[model samples]
Target chain A: MKMIIQPRDERTQPARIIAGYPQTPLRSPKEPLVKRAPTLSELSGPLEVAKRVKLLGGDIAGQGEKQAIGQLIHLRVRVLDEDGAPVGGAVVEMWQANAAGRYIHPNDDDHAPPDPNFYGAARVVTDESGVFELRTVKPGAYPVPTRDGWWRPPHVHFSVFGRVWLARLVTQMYFPGEPLNAQDRILNAVPDAAARDSLVARYIPPGVEPYNALVFEHQIVLRGRAATPAQP
Target chain B: MMIPTGEATIGPFFPPRYVDAGANDLTVFEGRKAKGEAIEIHGRVMQEDGTALENLIVEIWQADAGGIFRHPADPRHAQADPNFLGWGRAATDAQGNYRFKTIRPGAQEGRAPHINFMVMFSGLMRILKTTMFFEDGKDPVLMAVPAARRSLLIAKGNYEFNIRLRGENETPFFDD
Candidate 1:
């Protein structure tokens, strides 16, 4: 006996873009009309820390040797929703203190030597499964001004690109058991005790490489559906 | 309540349109898209009674570095930040809510007015982009509207202005 198969809809099928493989409903007038989610602001915590590098003052500079770390630091971040379903096409930007606790910026007055070889910034779009992997080095903790004193734990800042319909979240990732984490003013500012702890990265030593660095896994959620606009 | 009748001057910081057209390729030094931080600004736009109104389309535009416009009226300057496309389109939620993710424009000297936005909804047909001034702070004449908008902006590191949008509670408008 012969059997009849149904035709597949391309728009509903998983579409691949440079960012990631985005899966949406088959877009059609009759297809219950699931709206595409709004693009959210990017997560910019571990990324926007002011670095202290020589300002390239309107001059052409050659590419230097900052690639010495060889992308050894591994960042495996999973983008999820409140229900824990993987979110695809999430954009991630990561920049942190080099292994030596220094950044590349023009206004940095720290006078610490910068790795001429390192740009210390990288960007990647998440995969179809909402997973993004970045290979780099662990950044050392740097000090910033505080009322009582200067305090900062070794951590990475993360910024997320989210939808207008959803809430945008920006947070930092800290290694567990850092002494200064308790005293760092920024970390103490999160308001929720659980949310504060969620920002800390758990350690998984051994394997990966000979000089194994701590691995951090961060999960992000998209909140608040877009409300339908009212008629004037 | 005074309906804003004055002219509102906008910007010298408009973004110059990009010659390139890539969504993912964001290289700042090359005038490509840069990675912008993710943030959420959600709230309701209510009347004096806090009753929500809807059907408002919020539009935003800002200037890039060197205070230039996208596809500037004049040429001969550096390119605009591709990632910083100084324009956006948003409609209020069922509760008259609108949000956007624009960076705070930096300051420029001898500019027209403050960096204010053009908000349109209600009986307004066309998008009414307005230039708003702070209560009694800077000279609107010396500031750029894009920069002024950045003034009340909120972020992981800034102050946020919650607009009442109606009555005398609305922001000041400029003579454009």
Candidate 2:
């Protein structure tokens, strides 16, 4: 049987396009009506220290005998709540293709050879300081079939499971100064350029101490419009 | 008062590598049966155009039969069922079909029996959040929704729910 759903309540609705870009042409014209739930945010709750501890400090991508055959990078990030308080114990999961633009999964039929050393997945918990770090090689750009073969910019897929479902976020971290960011439709789906820019990670120059890898800092704000816009 | 975070698609190519062996069954823990009525929840992940959205990830979290969430934030004094995981994940098959073996979640303050859903797939810019309620419940949120559309949120007999990404009869998604 069919049901005529009501329009979403404005008070509970997020900002359209900018806050929750539907990704037009890509979004379903028959997409379901949005229902605003006052209890939705309560679905997530504080994770246990035991569960949190199990996820801390695991290499996500660089697991090969060699350094994974790409530019070495040291990525650091801080997780924060809406009130600007550091959120400890949140699980940060990351997965991505290797430096050769190939994932270590059977479904990735791109024919790009997977690096044996690159595990391609990692998990960590935000420490008491709300900071987490990962040592990995830069992922290469990969192509997906869109109109005439769309090439996804170099990016790492991130999934943050915060204390509450309201804080749960899944997004891609793009490299700063990547020319393809301008041409990519997924990145451009976000109407606000400033908000879109929040997805890019910036390079930090290696200090004189001679660290072997390039560093990038990307902070994840769980539920806020401040520095990092919350993912819809 | 905090603005909700935006979402991004989980992308295509999320292989079975991420699937934990027992992720699709919430009624069992370490081979022990959970302490609730076992029910089957089945649905299809379809696009607005009635096409199946294969390979999409569907994850669900809900409170146990005692109305207590497995999460630490549950304020109610209910005890959690040791054998109930209260969470499950499944990927849509070639036909965009997914199913879960779970229990009927109990009601809690300001809410009725329901299951929370998170959908992730390629083409989607971000994950979509929604809830499924039993037709028998009297949830204020469900009641507030228009009568005709309320059926969209209610699971029918046989516990079947079909998720439409867009188009006519689109499922009701939440901004929460």
Query: Which candidate leads in TM-score?
Result: 2
> What is the TM-score (0 to 1) of candidate 1?
0.43
State each model's CA lDDT, in order. 0.40, 0.69
Give candidate 2 misplaced runs (Cα > 4 Å): A1-32, A35-37, A40-57, A61-66, A147-149, A208-210, A224-232, B1-5, B30-33
Candidate 2 to native Cα RMSD, angstroms: 6.3
Docking class of 2: acceptable
Supply candidate 1's per-residue lDDT for A176.
Answer: 80
DockQ of 2: 0.41
Native contacts, share recovered per candidate: 0.00, 0.35
Alpha carbon deviation, residue A5, candidate 1 (Å): 39
Tell me, by lDDT, which candidate is best.
2
lDDT of 1 at A62: 18
